[model samples]
Target chain A: MGDRERRVVFVTVGTTCFDALVKAVDSEEVKQALLRKGYTDLLIQMGRGTYVPSKDSGKLNLQVDHFTFSPSIADYIREASLVISHAGSGSIFETLRLGKPLIVVVNEDLMDNHQSELAEELAERNHLFCSRPQTLQETVEAMDLDALQPYMPGEAKPVVALINKFLGFPV
Target chain B: MGLDAFAAACCAIPVLASLLAVRFAYVLCRSGLPPTRPRAAGLRCLIVLGSGGHTAEMMNIITELQKDRFTPRYYVAALTDSMSLQKAQVYEKSLIQGEGEKIIKNAQFMQIYRSREVGQSYITSIATTLLAVLHALWLIIRIRPQVIFCNGPGTCIPLCASAFLLKVLGLGWSSIFYIESIARVKKLSLSGLLLYKLRISDQFFVQWTQLQQKYPRAQYAGRLM
Candidate 1:
């Protein structure tokens, strides 16, 4: 019960196979950055990605764990000190809502380039760090945890009120 | 004399059809105004759930609403989408857990046929879409919801269209609200575009400011993720 705090960095690729992200997060460069940042543990939700972390990753002064998928990643996000995730809105918003520091890595190979649009907009607002697989290590190195502003949860109240008012329902 | 009357009948039919089309267009395109009759105490809300991201966003939106006021909620998803209905079930269970005191009740889940399968030919898709439309109409009439809520989902097209048809026919009506997906930063999804272009959605919402600027009809709702 009196254990020391375990600062964990969670990397999630969501439901898609983002092997590049899995490989990048498993690399020595990113691990070193995470270790230097005082993160004591590294966890990866590899999804359908083919890349697997080497068994010796735990010898690098960080406890490493990897899994293919979970029913829900909410608990993991809550446990994370920092989340490195894919740029999918589901993962991004979940982390933001949980008020965790996040780095969204965009998959450049995907035909739909619009995912980057949301990441860029959010990054511009200092909500999260945005990166590609190639630059993930650099993003991890340059991340400023304190610089990220806590995302104010989006409200549906106004919209609901408008709909009710339009329908002559009491708002 | 018979020949002359036959020709006159053809002209009259065309004229009547054109007039009906114009009137329908006017009804759809008119500015938003409150209904003359006040809505009933409790609203039967029909929520359309799409694929993964859309369903997640919808669940978030549903969480924000006052569950008591929106009684007898109906959730509709595509037949092929197995994950979405399961998610809905999980969400409803959580609602029961979250609010022990109120214990909001009466939520139903329904699945409709997909208009087109992946890699389906366009020629055959028309027939399936028509079937879907008929199925949607039946569902809408049976549910008779007062409000229909959907984000960017293709399945919503048939449902919203059915609701709008009811409105046009003056039989029964459900106000349609379309929220553009948050992922759509600069553009609307195909469903959003159709609803916007046809003036089918009574309230259209977009999350991004850039999208709102490009599509002025869409009100910027400030990122409802």
Candidate 2:
């Protein structure tokens, strides 16, 4: 059997905040910073990543893994050591459930700073590390995985039961 | 002379009376009397509030309002989280772009009762309506909008309350209750019945002229879209 790879960095750039990530990758300095931190490969899922099919182009020196859509996102979440995603409720909640350390980037256009609000809330609760494109490298390097441990590998049954009760169903 | 005819006539009288009363109240409120004149432009700001299919229909009116001189702002208080609020915002942004109007996608958690059981569905509909009314009231107070354009499914209650409050304060504007084309074409539900009470609007915009005739007090603004 092949040795299972641990500490895989899963990068998602298909969220509303894709532009920022794109801008970050386009910068030679950020690309070098990511390589220095040992994130050897970049998985560009969604957004502008899909449009640019050419591999080994632009300032991004790392291997480019692109996916249009995945039927089983949970499988990917389970396999990854660190999950980088847009500040979406679904992505944040799912990553926390899997016990994976999450780094979130907020989408600016969705609303007047809703992503920032969610990011701050999650950060305050010590559940995730959130950083903008400009500070992505610093935030990634300074991540405290221990802080996210309490939220990892939890079942959503309690939340489901709460919703069921609110809906007047027997929980 | 027949017994059936007499019963029909008796029922028609109260319906007609209520309709007239609503019309009279609407006219009294719509007319800018003395001190109310300054609030005329305020009244012109028609704030349409709803979620789902009703919100989609309201978007059509918002489009027309854009073409005309009257400025219309939209408040889309979504009842369900199943659909992305961003999708609704995108639609609103495209529809209201460069018009200097705003679309507020306020999220309200609602438990939709989808069972086919008639009795349970009816009760659930009533409960949901009450919750939406409460939400609408909260939004109305915050926005302080002069006129409320309600496209319903229980979100009208709070909006109506706000309109009522504004009227009392002499900042009273108009409310135009929109009876969506889809509801009339499809089967009627309990929520549709709740809408009958809100037949009173400063102006009621509907697709059909027959509805305007039935409630003679309502002005036929033609097809809103």
Over the stretch B19-80, how does candidate 1's per-residue lDDT look in tens digits? 77876775675535457788666789899999877898888778777776677789999999
How is the predicted docking of candidate 1 categorized under the CAPRI scheme?
medium
The reply for model 1, stretches above 4 Å from the true place, is A1-5, B1-12, B64-69, B90-105, B116-134
Interface RMSD of each: 1.6, 21.7
User: After best superposition, candidate 1 residue A148: deviation in angstroms?
Assistant: 1.4
Q: Say which candidate scores most in DockQ.
A: 1
lDDT tens digits by residue: candidate 2, B58-146? 55554444223233344444444334244445655675555454432221222232222223577677776666666665665655554
Query: Which residue runs does candidate 2 get wrong by more than 4 Å?
Result: A1-7, A13-17, A48-54, A57-61, A152-171, B1-225
Recovery fraction of native interface contacts for candidate 2: 0.00
Query: Cα lDDT for residue B91, model 1?
Result: 80
Q: Single out the weakest 10-residue window by summed lDDT for candidate 2 chain A.
A: A159-168
Top candidate when judged by lDDT against the true structure: 1
Candidate 2 is graded, for docking, as incorrect
Interface RMSD of 2: 21.7
